[model samples]
Target: MEQVAEKLGRPDAGDAAMGKAWGIWYGSDSTAKRRDEIAIYSSYRDTSMRVKDVKQIRITSNAFKTQDGLATGANLEDTKLKFPDIKKLSSYLNEKKDTVVVYDAKKEGIGFEFLKGKSISLTVHPVNTAVNDTYLTLHPEWKLIN
Candidate 1:
């Protein structure tokens, strides 16, 4: 925990929820106009807790991009062009009437959520993680893209 704080110049805040601990680093001027807040998640179980591995990374910044140049503000068409292997999963229309498209790059162990055809967030985690489980449960009409 100290190493991460030291490397990232100390987290602005942190929290614990859903069996995980999160250290959030708000962007600063030194970080090229850090407009996106970066969050790092670690496991918290019982009295034994350690930052052995990053459980997940939730990115909302446009500053960071995938190796293939995918980032928050990108459109679905460009995403498809950039990542031919990207799979289009089920989608849900939120209360705002914008369609939220869920995509999985299984090979890359990442999932992307797009709002109204524009990328909004990118989540890094295990490919088999149930990121869409709740959605599936709520919207059985939407089929998994396989």
Candidate 2:
């Protein structure tokens, strides 16, 4: 936690996983059209309760892009061009009650959440780790998209 705070400056620790985990948020604001947020999740197993061994990172802004120029707000078809192996995973209602479709490139350790056919967020995890294997909490009522 200390190392990350030093390297990335300070982060706003937000409640997540029903207070079982902390989600360190960067550039997260309520009013911005593009929040440019990056949330890092730490292991719940860590006894220290600090951000030791970050587990997942979620990017919710278009400011960050893949090497191939894919970013949030990108078209699903466009993203498929850059990640041909990506496949539809599921669909869930976001905070705004908008239907968000999730897709994953399992081997690449990257996933995308699409709203209205446009990417709205991206998640990065350990290479080869399936999305289902991560600690991320998904809405239980979500429907399988593929």
Identify the leading candidate in terms of TM-score: 2
lDDT scores of the candidates, listed in order: 0.67, 0.74
lDDT of 1 by residue, 1-146 (tens): 56666788867777765555677777765755335677776664345554344666767788888887778888878877876667877677655555778887766667778876788778676666644432213233544443
**In terms of lDDT, which candidate is strongest?**
2
Provide TM-scores for the models.
0.63, 0.76
Residue ranges of candidate 2 with Cα displaced over 4 Å: 16-20, 26-31, 44-51, 138-146
Global Cα RMSD, each model: 6.3, 3.8
**Across residues 60-105, which tens digit of lDDT does each residue of candidate 2 receive?**
8778888888889899889889889998877777556678888899
Clashes of 2: 0
Clashing residue pairs found in predicted model 2: none
How many steric clashes between backbone atoms does each model show? 0, 0
Mind sharing the TM-score for model 2? 0.76
Angstrom error of the Cα, residue 62, model 1: value is 1.9
